[model samples]
Target chain A: MTTSTPLQPVVQARGLVKRYGRVTALDHADFDLMPGEILAVIGDNGAGKTTLIKALTGAITPDQGEIRLDGKPVRFTSPMQAREAGIETVYQNLALSPALSIADNMFLGREIEKTGVLGSLFRMLDRAQMRKEARAALTRLGLMTIQNIDQPVETLSGGQRQGVAIARAATFGRHVVIMDEPTAALGVKESRRVLDLILDVKKSGLPVVLISHNMPHVFEIADRIHIHRLGRRHAVVRPSDVTMSDAVAIMTGAMEPPAQAA
Target chain B: MSTDQPSSAPRGPQAFEKVLPENEAPVRFEAERESGIKRFQNLLHSHPTAIPGIVLVASLVFFSVMVGGRFLHPFNFSLIVQQVMIIGIVGIAQTLVVLTAGIDLSVGAIMVLSSMVMGRLAVEMGVPTPLAIAAGIGIAALCGFANGVLVTRFRLPPFIVTLGTWNIFFALNLWYSASETIRAQDIEASAPLLIFFGQAVELFGARLTYGSIAMLAMVAIAWYVLNRTAWGRHVHAVGDDIESARLAGIRTDRVLLMVYVVAGVICGIAAWALIGRIGSASPQAGQTANLDSITAVVIGGTSLFGGRGSIVGTLLGALIVGVFRNGLALSGVNVLWQEFAVGVLIIVAVAIDQWLRRTSR
Candidate 1:
C-alpha cells in the first residue's frame, strides 16, 4: 500500500536502551532519519520520545546500541560534541537567554571579534557585522517586522522568538535539526509561521527530526512518521500510505482495522 | 510549503495552539503599543532592577535638606568625605564579592587585623614604615586568599567560609593588641609617612582630604573594573547564570576566588585610611564596617541575585550615608540616635526603591 519508495536514511539508530532509576525510559528503540525529509516522532506522555532524542543528541547516555550519522559510527559525549558533528536540537524551552537581545542570544558563547590588539585592548564587539548577519537570518525567516535586533528576547512574542531560535539552528550550519515540540507554547498564527520556517529549512537541503504528540501536525508536515511503543519504534509509515485513523490506531496500540480499509 | 497557504490563521502542531491558552496571549507584542520615547522612559522607570540606586540618590537629597543646609556646606561636606572614606573603600571591596551573590562578613575584622599588624611591625619590630605598611596589607591579602581557597577548593558556601574567617581575624586582632589601642606615638615612630592620609588638601573655596581623594580614586577604578573590563562581563555572566556561564566555558570558580582576594586587598587599603584618620589602631576599630558596607551595596542598586550593579551607584550610596550622619551631627542631633537615623534611612531608601521598581514594571 506504500506509494513512494523509501529514501536514504541520514541517521540510523540500532538497539538503543536507557533506564532511569526504576523506570525504563527507552528499551532497544531503533529510529531512522531520511535525507532532506521531515520525520515526525509522536507518542503519548512518558513514551520515551524525549529520552530517545536526548540520548541521540548527547544530552543523556544510553546503555546500549549504536547511532550512525551520515553512515559514520559515532558516540556524542556532550551537546557540544553533537553540535560539532552537525547535529542541532531545539528544545521545548528553546534555550534562549531572555536577558540578552536576539543577536546576542544567537551568538551567546561564540562572538565574532574584530581584528588587532586594539580590539583586544578595547574589548569592542563587532556590532556592525553581527547586526548585518542577524538581520539576514531574520529576513530569511520572514521576520522582518522585528525592527530592533538589539532589544532583549523577553520582548518578543512566542512565534517571533521561536522563529529566531529556528533561524539560529539553521544559521549554525548543522546538517540535522531536531526540534523538541517547538510549537508547544505558541499561538495558531505563530505555530503556522514556525511550520513555514520548517519548510524553508527543508528547502535549504537540511533534514529535520520533529518530535510531537500532535497527529494532525505530523500528517501535515512530516514526509515519514515513526511511532514508539513500549520501548521500541513500532512503525515508520509515509503520510500518503495511511489515513489519520490508521496512524492513530498504530499510535494507540490497537491492532483492529476499519471495515473500509479491508 | 504544501501550497504556500495564506489563510488568516497559520496552522501547525495542534497541541500548542488548541490547548495552553497561556501561550496564545501574545503580551510581549503589546510592548510595542507605546511610542519609542515612552518605551525608553518605561525601560528606565520600570527597571525595578535599579531601585537601590534610586533610593541612594533620594536619601542623599532628603538628608541634605533635613540638616538645615549644613549638609552641603563646604567644610561639613569635606568632613563627610573624610569620615566615610574607610567605609567607601571597604564598600568597593564588598561590591566585588556581592556582585557574585556572595558576602564577605570578615571585612571589618580583616581591616582591624591588617592595621594591628602594620602598627606592631612598625612599632615593636623596628621594621621600616613602608615595609610595615606593605606587611599589613599583605596580611589582609593572605586572609582573603584563605577565604577564597575555602570557598572555591573546598566548595564551602561563601557565607560559612567568610563567617569563619571573620571570627578568626577578630580573635587575632584582639590577641595582637591585647584589647588595648595602638597609640599614634607607637605608630608615628614606625609609619609616619602613612599619616599623611589624615591631612587635608585645600582646593578653591574648600578642602578635599587625602583619604577622601584616595577613596574617590579607588571608587573610580572599581567602577571601571566592574563595568568596562572583560573580567567584568564574565563576572556578571557568572552571577546572572552559573550554569550558562559554565556551558560557555567560563572559569567561575577561579573568578569567585579572584573576587574574594580583590576584596581582601581593598580591606588592607581601608585599614591604612582608618588608622590614619583615627590616629590609632584599636581592636575595636571598624566594628560596624561590615554591616555598613553591606548597606551601601544594597543601597547602590546592585541586585542581591548578582549579574546587575554599578560602582558609581555604590559610591553615591556611600556618600549619601556619610552626608546624613555629618549633617545630623552638625545640627545638634543626639549622637546616640545617629545609628537609628541611618537605619531608618536604609529602610526608607529601600522602600522608595521598591516602589519605583514595581511602578516602572
Candidate 2:
C-alpha cells in the first residue's frame, strides 16, 4: 500500500532451491527484504520457511540461487561468514552457553583481545572491557533488570535470557538483524517486552527479517508480510492491505494471492 | 457559604482526590533468604575444590593425631609429595580432557608406552637419550592426534574411542617393550637423564625430589593457561555446549582436537616424570593410573560432565589421595582398607559434585 514508487531492497534471493533426500524443502523460492522495514515471514508447517531463512543466513547452502546484498552477489559458506557480512541471526533456541557469564556469552565468538604483546602472545582477553561494554549494550537496549553481567546465563529468567541474546545481536549486527521466533517461548509479559525490543531495534534504523507463526504479532509490527506456501513464496502483501484470515487463506492455499500483491 | 470563606471551601472535585480506592499492590513472591546450610552449599558449588581441600586437611590432622604426630614430620610430608607426583602429573592430562567433557582412558597407556620408547631407544637401540625422549613424546602426540581425528572426523564418541585406544596402546606397549621391565641399574648407567628426576634436594630439612617440583610447575602452568587464555575459554565453551559454541562461530572440532593433542603432550611429560619417580621404564608401571587420575580429577572438583573445573583443584585432589594412603598406612590400617577408603572417597566426591550442581540449579 505504501508502494508509491519502487524501492531498492537490502537483500534479495532469486530461484532458490534445496532438496533433502526425497523431500523438496525449498522449491525455487524468491524473496526480498526492503531496506529499513520489518519483513515478516509466515508459513504453515512444512512450508519451507526455515529452509529459506537458513539459506539466506548461510546456515545452509541452497542447491541453486542468486543472493545479492547491497546489489552485490555474495556467497557465505558458514554462519561466521554471514556474520562478517553484517548479517546476525538470533535463533529460536537463543544459542547462549548456559554455563558462561552474560558478558562472556555476549562476546562469545568475537572476543575482544587485550592490546599489545600480551594479547598477541598469550591471546589474553580484555575481560574488563568486554564486561563494561556488555553492560553498556544491555543498558542501551533497556535490559537493566539484569544486575550482574558476570552471572551465568542459566541464572536468568526466560525473558532476561532472550533480552541478552537480543542485546548481543543488536550490539554486533551492523547491517541486518534476523530473528527466528524470538518470542515463541515467552509468556505474555515477556513477549510484550520482546515485541517492544523489536520495535526498539527497528527505531535504531536497522532492517529486520522476522520469522514467526504468530499472526497478530506479525501484523502488528510488520511492514510487509511474506506468506510462504508449498515450498515457495505464495504472496507478499502489505499488512494494511490484508486481513489475518486472508493471509492465512493464502498461506494454506484456500485462496490465491491478490493480484496487486503478486 | 460566606464570601470570605469561599476561598477555603473545597473545590467542586479536587484532582488529587481518589476516584476509587487504590488497590493494594499485587502479592509478589520474593525468594526467601538462604539459610546457613544453603549458603554453604552455594559456596561449595561455586568453588568445587573446597570440599576436597577440607577433606585433605582433615585427613592430615587425623593421621597426625592417630600416629602421635609422626605423620606431621617434614620427612613424611615430603614423602607424601613424592608418592603423589606421578598421579599429579598424569592428572594434568586427564584434567584437560575432562574439561572438554571428554575422557582419555588411554592416558596411562600413552605414558607407559612413551616411557618404554624412551627406555628401548636409549638402552637397546643406543639412540641418544634426549632424542629418544623427544621421539617418545612425539609418539604420544601422534596417538593423541589419532584419537582426536577419530573423535572429530569420524564422529565417534570419545569414551568408546579412547577405551578402544587404551587397549590398543597397552597391547602396543607390551609388544614394543617385549614385556621386559627395564632395570633401574641399566637405566641409570645408559640413560642417566631418564632417571634425573629421581635426584633429590634437601629443602628445609625435608627431601624434595625433582619429580615433585616438576609436577607442581606443570600444574601451575596448567592453571595459568586454563584460567587466562582464549584457547582455554574455547575448550570450556565447547564442553559447556557444543552446539552453542559452534553457533558462536567457534571451531569446536579444532578445540576438541587441540585438547586431545595437548592432553597427550602432558601425558608424555608425565611419562618422563614417571621414569624419574620409578628410576625405570617398565611396561607394568601406571597400571592403575587411568582410574587414579580420574579419581584425582573428580575429587579435585573438576566435573566429569566437563566445562567447569580447575587445575589447582586437581593438584589438591592428588595430594588428598596421597595423604589418605599414607595416613592409613601410618595408622596401621590394612592395605585392603586403604583401597576401600579410596573407593568411598571417590563415591563421596562424585556425590558432593552432584549435590553442588543441584544447589546452583
Candidate 3:
C-alpha cells in the first residue's frame, strides 16, 4: 500500500559485515526502515537476527558497515551513544532490575536531580518528576490499569513487563525502536495487547524493527518482512505482494529454486 | 444499549453462579507445595562471609555466662568498650571496601604507617599536635589513593592489591620509626590525650569511658554513609553487577576509588583513637587489629559478596568479641583458652552467615 508521497526512511544500513573467529555471523546485509512502518525480521535460531540488531544498536561493532540515522553516517562506541542518537532497543531479557520499581527501572541511570548542595551531598533523586512522566508514558500506551508505578517489576506479569519496556523505548521519543520478540512468550490475549501497543508506537510517527519467528503474528502486523537465511538478508517482501503460503515457501527455500540458471 | 443490557441480564447471573476455583483444588494444592519447597530451598542457602561475626558473639556469650558472669560488671564493660574502640573504628573502613565486593587487608599496616606519620610530624619534625593529626590523615589518604589506583586502574583483584600494600606499609613503618616507640610526652605537653583512657565518668556507682562514645559515633556515621547517601547506592550497584551499572552510565570505577579513599581516611581516624587509648605508638602496634576487625565484620550480617550488609551488625559483633575476652580474663579462663574460644567463634559466625545468605535468596 504505497502512499501518494514516499515516506522518508528513519534508519538505513548497507553492506553490514560481522565475523566471529572464522564463522561469519552477518555478511553484507542491507535494511531500510521507513517512518511509521512496522518492519519484521524473521529467521530461525542463530540466523543472524541477534547479530544484526546488536550491530544496528551499537551493542557490538561490525567490521564493515555504514549505519545512517536519516541519511547521516554515525558510529556508536557504547549503548549510551546509541540511546542519545535515538536508537532504543528492548532486548528479550528486558534489562530491568527486578528489585527496583517500574519508575526506578525506567530512570535507573539517567535520574533527574535537583541542582544544589543537598543534591551533591545527598544525591537526591527527583522521584516526583520521574513518576509523573512514567505514568504519562504508560497511559499513552493505553496501560492505565497499572496504577502503582512504584511496584517492584518482579510483581508484574510477562505482558506487563513488555509493556513497560515498550513504554520506556518510546517515551524517550526515539527515532528507531528495536524490539526482540515482544510477544513470543505471551499468550493469545497478551500477544494481541502487545501488537496493539506496537501499532500505537507506529502511529506516534516512529519506525519499529520487530524480530520474531512467528509468521502468522508477523503477517498480522508487519508492512514489510525481511527474511535472513545463511547469514544474509535473502529478500524483502511486502505482505500484500505475497500470501502466507508463498511467504512460508520462500522462508523454507522451497520456492524460487534454480534462479542461478536464469 | 438497552437490547444488549437485556440480553446479558440472565446470562450474567448464570455466569456468576458457575464458580470454577473450587473445582481446581488439585492444581492449587500442587502450586502451594512448589512455592513452599522453593522458599525452603532459598532459606537453606547462606553466605560463608557472615559466619565469623555470629560465632564471635555466640561464643562470647557462652564464655561470659560460664565465667561466673564477670563480663557483666560495669567496670569490665567499660574496659571491653575501650578495648574494641580502635578495632571498631578501623572496621568501619574495612566495611566500606567489603561493601564494594573488595577488601583492604592493609588496614592494620595503614594504621601503623599513619601513626608513624604522626610520630614523625610531632616528635621528629617538631609540629603541633593538631597539625600532626592532620598530617596522619593526609598520609592515610595518600596510601589509600595508591591502593585505589592500583586496584581500579589496573583492574587488579582487591585482595591481592591490599595484601601487597600491607607489606609495603609494614616496611615503611619500620623504616620511619627505626623500631622506636613514640612516647606521649615527646612533643605534645598534655598527657590528658594519653591519660584520657584512665579517666572515666563516675555517675551513680557506674562510669562510662569517652572512647566508647567515640566508637559509637563512628559506627553511626558509617551506618549512615553506607545506607543513606547516593554514594552508598553507587557502591551497592557497582558491587551487585558492575557491567549493568556501567551500562546505566554509573561511574563505577570512580565510586570504587572513593570507597577506598574514604576507608583510608577512616583508618587515620582509628590510628588517633588507638594513640589516645594506649598513650604510645609503635610499628608493632595494631598487628592483629586487621584480623580482629575483619573477624568482627564477618560476624556482622554484611555479606562478603557485596551489595548487602549493615554497620550496626558490625558494631554489635565487635562488642560481643570484646565482652567475651574481658569476661574470660576476669574469670581467669587463661589466655590460651581465650584464643581457642575466639578461633572457634570465627568458624561458627561464618557458618551462620552462610545459612543466612542461603535463606535470604
Tell me the tens digit of each residue's lDDT in model 3 across B48-135: 2234445556666676677654555666667777888888888888888887889889998898889778877776777766788888
User: TM-scores across all candidates?
Assistant: 0.78, 0.93, 0.76
Task: By lDDT, rank the candidates, best first.
Answer: 2, 1, 3
DockQ of 3: 0.12
TM-score of chain B of each: 0.84, 0.91, 0.82
* Clashing pairs for predicted structure model 2, backbone only: none
Tens digit of lDDT per residue, candidate 2, span B264-299?
Answer: 888888888889899889999998888899999998
Q: Candidate 2: where is the Cα deviation over 4 Å? A: A1-6, B1-30, B33-36, B359-361
Q: Cα deviation in Å at residue B345, candidate 1?
A: 3.9
Reference-based lDDT, each prediction: 0.76, 0.87, 0.75
Worst 10 residues of 1 chain A by lDDT: A253-262
Instruction: Select the stronger candidate by DockQ from 1 and 2.
Output: 2
What is the two-chain DockQ of model 2? 0.23
Docking class of 3: incorrect
> lDDT winner among the candidates?
2
Which candidate tops TM-score?
Answer: 2
| Candidate 1 C-alpha RMSD relative to the actual structure | 5.9
What stretches of model 1 exceed 4 Å from their correct place? A1-14, A63-76, A80-86, A112-114, A119-136, A242-252, A255-262, B1-41, B45-70, B110-165, B172-188, B191-200, B209-231, B241-282, B348-361
